[model samples]
Target: LEAINLRERKIIPAIKKGETVVLDFSHAITATHSFLTALLADPIKILGLKSYKQIKIIGANETIRTIIDF
Candidate 1:
């Protein structure tokens, strides 16, 4: 929750201000659905699809990619 809050307050604002945001998922070998939702879902909701058109996600494995893409 703390991590999510920081991203919400800082990263989301940066993205909103027209900065490019790169989210690297390499450190985590696996991500739970709840973790992914908490980490990313709110930003998508707040920023909308148009804003995320250029966002980059790095090093996600197939399962993670499937969940995220779905």
Candidate 2:
């Protein structure tokens, strides 16, 4: 699809150092930005994302974490 194509052709290049991008709506999911963000969290920190932002849902919302860790 277009998302896969964009990653193969475009977005990958922009994921380098000192990069700041805003993922909105369609591109957010299509680019699999959340997964990519989680995958690249350490690198992004090393590359210098002053504040590391990871999503945290409290209480009974730990299902995704369980799913991911499992």
Candidate 3:
């Protein structure tokens, strides 16, 4: 959760500045729903849903992709 908060602080501003954030999930085995939500939910709230169109998550397997899609 602390990590998520740190990233949110960094990422939200980058997105607000119209920077693209690419999150590569290649090495990650899995993520909890809470972790995923904490990492993204606030950014989505602040940036608006349209901002999500600019963010990218690569190398997500089916399970991670499914979680991300939600």
Candidate 4:
């Protein structure tokens, strides 16, 4: 949770500046719903759904992709 907060700190600033953020999940096999929600909570709250435009997710497997879609 602390790590997620730290990452959000960096991501929010960049997104505010209109920079694209690439989230690489190459080595990650899967993620919990809570994890993804926690990861995105701040950006979605602060920037709204439009924040999705600034976030690029790569290397996510089908299941992870599906989870993210949910």
lDDT, candidates in the order shown: 0.76, 0.40, 0.79, 0.80
lDDT by residue (1-70, candidate 3, tens digit) is 7647756677777888888888888998888787878777767886799778767889888898889788
| lDDT preference between candidates 1 and 3, better one | 3
The candidate scoring highest on TM-score is 4
lDDT-based ranking, best first? 4, 3, 1, 2
Of 1 and 4, which scores higher on TM-score?
A: 4
Candidate 2: where is the Cα deviation over 4 Å?
Answer: 26-70
Per-residue lDDT of model 2, residues 8-35, tens digit only:
4444445553344443333221224455
RMSD of 2: 7.7
Report backbone clashes per prediction. Answer: 0, 0, 0, 0
Better of 3 and 4 by TM-score: 4
What ranking of all candidate models by TM-score puts the best one first? 4, 3, 1, 2
lDDT of candidate model 3 versus the reference: 0.79
Candidate 1, residues 1-66: lDDT per residue as tens digits? 754885677768878888877778888687888777766776778778765664678989888898
lDDT for 58 (candidate 3): 91
